[model samples]
Target: MGIISPGFFGRRRRDVPGLPPGQHLTEDFPVLSAGPTPRIREDEWEFTIRTEAGGAHRWSWEEFITLPQEDVTVDIHCVTSWSKLGTGWRGVSLDTLLDSVESTAEYSMAHSYGGYTTNVPVADLRDGKAWIVHQFDGSALAAEHGGPARLLIPHLYFWKSAKWVRGLELLRHDAPGFWESNGYHLHGDPWREERYW
Candidate 1:
């Protein structure tokens, strides 16, 4: 993506700087979810990031909007052979959410209201690497595509960037997530084609 910000990890490792290996680019953003869509009202939404030892930061839908926000253009690669390029999103950076929390956790387990969880290295979320997005293409995100808010970590396979995100639990050690525990790779990198363990 030409709009990729400086110091993005995916850019640092590649020369071609386009789609990852084994993924075909697509313009249409597909709607994929593990189960039925959950309709969440804005007044009832909440997001939290907590450390295993107990420090936590939480925001309601209203509070979340008051924090700093930015627009991002990214190329997203899904594990199912589809890559969507030049996707636009608006949200708060994960860096902001973890700013006040004092913790030394190296891993994070993203928890969704629907009981879905995905794990990722905490380092991957800092310094503009990840976001919790509520808007897509300048419009409010649809319920089918994870409304209210969803984690967006474009560097990894889309599954790692979970939908319907509600809270994040920082961990001292690495752990497999839903798909990872069920056969998907622990660390999914589309370029390496790490779709499964």
Candidate 2:
């Protein structure tokens, strides 16, 4: 089943400052999920990075949290036309997590806890552009919003930031992920309004 949000066809407001083209500012964050929320215990949570060469980098929840953390404040735009501005998040940068791993892959497929997956360019995941966020709005992220951890790629449409992110598989070639295979844009740039294929 596809992810569903209540205001998918809500009226767009173009006058709002900082909103992308065809987007409206929203004060409340909406919950959209493709399936039932999985309740994962912190101790059982593990994140892995699998390389194209079949090597793997694994991090348990205990080890993951000890890494460097950064506080981020950025605007998030959803393909559904709602944009939330100045959202605060706390997480470890993808650069830090990927520093030791070596890959010539140009793309990555993010795997999430509840079987959600999204494709992203390796370049977009580096250089401090993305994060593995565990906290939102100064608190532990809520389960409905991908609590324990989620991939945060603010520059792209929100769906690219897969919720409940568990691991990332490096791919030498680009592959359409869950949404992309379902006709969502392969590169979901909010500014470009690349919502559908």
Candidate 3:
């Protein structure tokens, strides 16, 4: 795994002042790095969550949108060395989603397109540090940037905030995600600068 040094927290010339303290900024914000966006119809968009037992629930775009939404300000650290500070996002909390499904799993993983996945603890999920984001900077998410819905994890490295997130898979054990399997750090903590193993 590789370590990242985002030039945030007033460390970078372009750093903004809206984020909470101790948050740093990364060099670049690759809005379209994942490539061209996909064409997804609202009628076809579905978000599902499954427990290890395979018991699952699905949400149509309409149903998902019907859930309560909240405004959040979080710091993001990317594996590529860029941090977006004080990013304003509006979306449903993981707890809200879990409560909707009445989840029982103690741990969880988020899976997205491009074979991307990230492991997370239920405690993090319940802490309001994450969200199924629909809007960024007060605008609807663009596809290249994981539109429709993406997971926003403030505490962990940005990769943990999986983009183009299709659903969350509840797990009984912790499993490494795409980057994790590829030598990226398991737990990316910015304060200690723990970007890799």
Q: By lDDT, who's the top model here?
A: 2
- Residue-by-residue lDDT tens digits, candidate 1, 132-195: 9999999998888888789999999999988889999999999998998989999898888999
* Per-model lDDT: 0.90, 0.92, 0.76
Displacement of the residue 21 alpha carbon in candidate 2, Å: 0.5
* Candidate 2 residue-wise lDDT, 12-45, digit = tens: 5346677888787879999888889988889999
Q: Which tens-of-lDDT digit does each residue in 1-197 have in candidate 3? A: 35666854443566366433345565456662345566565677788988778878888889989999999988776666667766789888987888856666778889876556788877778867779988989999877778878898888777788777888998888778777777877777765666676
Candidate 3 CA-lDDT value? 0.76
Candidate 1, residue 100: the lDDT equals 75
Count of backbone collisions within predicted model 3: 7
Off by over 4 Å in 3: 1-28, 32-37
TM-score of each: 0.90, 0.92, 0.81
* Model 1 per-residue lDDT at 52: 81
lDDT at 48 for candidate 3? 91
Q: What is the clash count of model 2?
A: 0
Q: Which stretches of candidate 2 lie over 4 Å from their true place?
A: 1-14
Give RMSD to native, each candidate: 8.0, 5.5, 5.1
